[model samples]
Target: MITMKEIARRANVSSATVSRVLNNSGYVSDDVRKRIMKIIEETGYIPSEHAKALRTKQSNVIGVILPKLSTETSSRLVNGISEELAKHGYQILLANTNLDPEKEIENLKLLKSKQVDGIILLATNRGQELVSEIQKLSIPFVATGQVIEGVPSVINNNFQAAKDITSHLIEKGHQKIAFIGVDEADWEVGHRRKEGYLAALKENQLRIVDEWIQKGIFSIESGYTSMKKILESGNERPTAVVCVTDRLAIGAMEYLGEIGLSIPNDIALTGMGASDLSKYVVPRLTTIDLLSETTGAEAAKTLLEIIKEGNTSDKKVIDYRLIIRDSI
Candidate 1:
């Protein structure tokens, strides 16, 4: 392996001069930099990141804790994070918790031990245990998808997004609207979204039936099962339904199709997350675009800023777009 010393020797420069050029830390003449770079290119010499980190006390690595790895939202967010971090010569150490809350805390401790410069958590819930664990970490931490008090986060306005979608359904003359949401333990997707749906109904002077509200996990099958129960519960049925996510809405659509119910004609449907499947599904879903990638990029930027500067609590709320489709 060709070392920086060899490159410097061949380029007729000192090792410190090569270091200054490669790290871009100190002043070096353009001619010297060009010569060193040319010698490095010719030799195909690669700098040791480990040695660089030791010298600078910066690993140039960010730790990312995700709830799940397979979801579309997660994939897009990661792509955005990767794109933004690469520009600053930073890489990510991914820790997938597979939707386990305990693993979130565990991953935080583990990543901190690995000497990551900072951490970005795609949080599932705002449990006190998780917040307490985060407070103990010395490095900068940023949360996405959920808010934690006293912690910096990049989040979507779930309440307002849900309210907008519900109000849109009402404008389409949907008086009887049903809601499909996740467990309230997840404040962003579950509690805030349901609160928005209820708020819209109350503001519009529309009646909400207890039977119309159903809870489901974040899954297609869960949505299907929830819809099935809603359909079988009572003689009174909703003219429209608002789901917390596109996956759930797709599952409900599948159930509706199985029951010979035509979308919009029989029941209008809307969902959050403008997923790829949303467009391909029959009667293409009317949904909210939470700008998952933008949020992820923003989170990466925020964490980097905190790492550069001192830690300060800040929250960034990304805007949402209501995507009107054939479903409604």
Candidate 2:
């Protein structure tokens, strides 16, 4: 590797002069600075980020903790975050948990130890253990998805989104509508969405069927299973279904298809997340768009605000829009 000493010798300047030019500190003649910069560009000399971090106490990097990198929502969110952070000369170090809740806390500690200038957590569950660990972080931190009290977060109005989608089904005259959701442990996707669905039903004065409300995991297979259980529960078939996620809705749609059911004609369907699949599916799915990429962008923006300005808003709420497609 060509060292600064070599560049100094080539430029006919002392090492101190080269150092001053690299750091942009003290003084260096404009001609000499330009010459050194040209040499750096020609040689493709990369500065030691580690050395800079130690000297300035800034990593110029942020750590991002996400649940599963494979999901469409997760990938879009990361893209949004990377795009916004890049504008501010910040790079992201990613830690994917593959949906394991424990890994969220572990990555938190790990990122802290790496001396990241800040952290953006793509939170899944708002568990006490995870919140406690987050509270202990010493660096600028922001989260997206689930909310954490007193901690800045970027979130979608899951409850309101759910209520609106359910109400949409109601407006289409779907009084007997089934709901497919995940475990309530996922406060935002599960508990909050269920609450919204229930609220919409109660507002419309529709009877709630216990068996029509099904809980499943975050998988298409789980969605299929939940839909199957709902149908076989010996209750009258619902006119429509509201799934908390597109994957779940897809699975349910598949199941309905296998049973010779035609969408909208047989049963209307609505999903959340507005994944690409939702737009291309047969009959196209009427779904809720969480604007996931915007959520990620806001999370990174909030963290940078905290790191650079020593201040940030408590929360940023990204509005969810009801996308009208043919499925509903």
Whole-model Cα lDDT of every candidate shown, in order: 0.93, 0.91
Worst 10 residues of 1 by lDDT: 305-314
Q: What TM-score against the true fold does each predicted structure earn?
A: 0.95, 0.94
Clashing pairs in 2: none
Instruction: For model 1, name the residue pairs that clash.
Output: none
lDDT score at residue 86, model 1, on the 0-100 scale: 96
Best by TM-score: 1
Highest lDDT: which candidate?
1
In model 2, the runs with Cα more than 4 Å from the true position are 9-20, 23-29
Each candidate: how many clashes? 0, 0
Report the backbone clash tally of model 1. Answer: 0
State, as a TM-score between 0 and 1, how close model 2 is to the true structure: 0.94
**Candidate 1: global Cα-lDDT?**
0.93
